[model samples]
Target: MPAAHHPDLELDDIQAGALAERPSPYVGKYLLLRITDRADGRELVRRLHRIATASRTSERTDDTTLTVAFSYHGLEALGVPQTSLDSFAPEFREGMAARAAVLGDVGESSPEHWEAPLGSTDVHVAIAALSPDAARLEAAAEQARRAHAELPGLEVVWRQDCYQLVTGRTSFGFRDGIGQPAVEGSGRPSTNPREPSLKAGEIILGYPDETGELPPMPMPEVLGRNGTYVVFRKLHTKVAAYRNYLRDRASNREDEELLGAKMVGRWQSGAPLVLAPDRDDPELGADPQRNNDFLYAEDARGFKCPVGAHARRANPRDSLYQDGSVDVRLHRMIRRGTSYGPMLPPGELEDDGEDRGIIFVFAGAHLKRQFEFVKTQWLNDGIFIGAPEERDPLVGPNDESSGFTIPQRPIRRKLQNLPPFVVTRGGEYLFAPGLNAMRWLSELDT
Candidate 1:
């Protein structure tokens, strides 16, 4: 046991420390935020120029935290250096000092615990684009590779393209980038709030002591921080496989729109099929006030949208409310990913060849409580919440070998008869450091 900084104080110190760390050339796009000490609804935005200049060829993407999570990648061509553990020694000390100052603590804090080398599975780099042109994808892929290589000690864990031969969109299809959570007061809540208030220690470290404090470490020592768990996974979708599966089993009266509703659990318009069962409701999907307003209780047993559908499993809504109180707040994930590779070639589409998928990014306070638990217990496991079924038909993994399976059923078919359809390819876990953490690295003593 050691002296640790208060959680509130740690937040600001973490940001300042990361800013001190030089921006890596491999970093393409990033979103950084400093939480307000109070709820005045104000945010501290770090000036990009103050840290590092963007490469001339760099394409920057950022937004308010709630609209979309932060995402970063350097094109393999960027020639960024890989940062090593030795490169981050000195900055670790400064970060601890910054943390102590923010918390108003008086003592020599140690940084050894936070300065250790990140695990191999904790980082990932992926590439995706519009069409199937190897030249185009290769350029992006190379940029990511070079960026990782330049960072002396940071490891690049996994990489893959979306599965497109079967569908027109990325592996998961249904025009992803939907269902993202919106930060409080940013506007209307686009996505539910995952946690009521920010819990700094829980996010950066595995778990804090009962007193809600993190152990103190020398500004440059890497102790107490043994392992940082990261989950990396590449999901490949058979878009064509999904479409054909739907069309073949669709009743003459059920059009393609209806078929998509059943498969995706929502229409392309973002409307949940469970509410607009018989038709595609563009109005509902577009209405900020009405879009996320339905409960699975409408169909109780998942008659409107199958319990095995991706949307249903990803967010159970009222289904999980034991006392008729819908609390979907905990299951939310901040997805900070991008599309990789190119769209399928026109000829390849006809031949049922591979296309592309997405580099799915899910980060939360606790890996086991948030992302891992959701995937293993709910998404991948068939019998979630005590149901007789296996798992979400679209994203559920059948076994380690076969990947995923999409269950099929007649338009009016009972829940028991559906066959499996979707599949998984490859993936890994990664740690998205806050701006403060980045700065702390740049100033570390070699």
Candidate 2:
């Protein structure tokens, strides 16, 4: 395929789970299912196809974006060839059960420790329902349950619901869902034009990615076209403790707010520190056009936004160019996060003992390079940023020796003994295929 000649995608057939600009103030429910008999797998796929939604249209007053995806085992149950399965990404082929410890999902979240529905041979399908309206969201979820009821060998294994914070904040209180990469042909352009455009193959399969070659995909071109991989992680945040940490480190309320902003690389209002270094600029943050326009090239000294800050490490923008222009667009991911459980009441500064965190969804064609690499290299290590052995201040695993420093005049302020605020509960890797693939699954012969 020519680099300039972009493919004409059938957006109407692709699942909306990976689409950009999904409905806001949304509620999402995840479903894990089991396929009882290979003989019934074909029928099961047909029911699932009937329930899943196509990508969103150009104009819509409202939406309940319902989507359905399947694990590698789910496809195998539907008669996909072993050769095709082997063609998938290695980490995905290994499945979440084998990759949990490497991903830091241990202790309470290890495969053995997970609920029966997760990491089990019987578990197959993964479905997601997202909607701005709670009633529509609930109805879509029920529709999936009823559809499952009609299939003989299908059983609903486990379910969990996650909702957007009313303030558009994640459990960490930073404005979420910023800095997504723009794909070559996807109508949703990049938020920052200065940032390079990523090839469609970096996200959707069957297209040319950064290597100028198509990523290895499953058998049958129709099934892989417009299809992409998705990794779901349920991360539980210890909210009150995080707030307390900030409060304890700062001298006054104003200092506390600045400290939190410095750690996150953005204010609660979503204004990046790189652009508004000294204070939180609500107007600049609220302006979608300007909020994500800045990069870290000028602030390499960590004077504006610290090099190890959460947002900088997560995307980096043009920060890595000085060392010979590191092309980071290929490593991008479409990240959609929603906080679950009850919010800690305002003005309280202690552990509330409530379960709450973000439901993290990563969409891309290259799982290892985009998702796994970012977690292990960018977020977990500081070598690339000139700070060796350091990790992200907020999300990195607690070592009791970790610290954060804000570069300022005279003496830089440094805080130590930073503890991790988020813990992994459970997660899975799935394939969100095109509509044609759904039809193909339904017709696969025993």
lDDT of 1 by residue, 237-339 (tens): 5565555555566676357566566656887766787668778777876664665666676676666777666777787766777674334555555553344
TM-score of each predicted structure versus truth = 0.56, 0.94
Residue 196's C-alpha lDDT in candidate 1? 42
Which candidate gets the maximum lDDT versus the true structure?
A: 2
C-alpha lDDT of residue 272 in model 2: 95
Cα lDDT tens digits, model 2, 70-137, are 88888888788777778777887778778876776655556776656666566688888888878888
Q: lDDT score, residue 251, model 2? A: 92
Candidate 1 residue spans exceeding 4 A from truth: 1-173, 182-231, 253-256, 323-328, 344-351, 399-412, 415-423
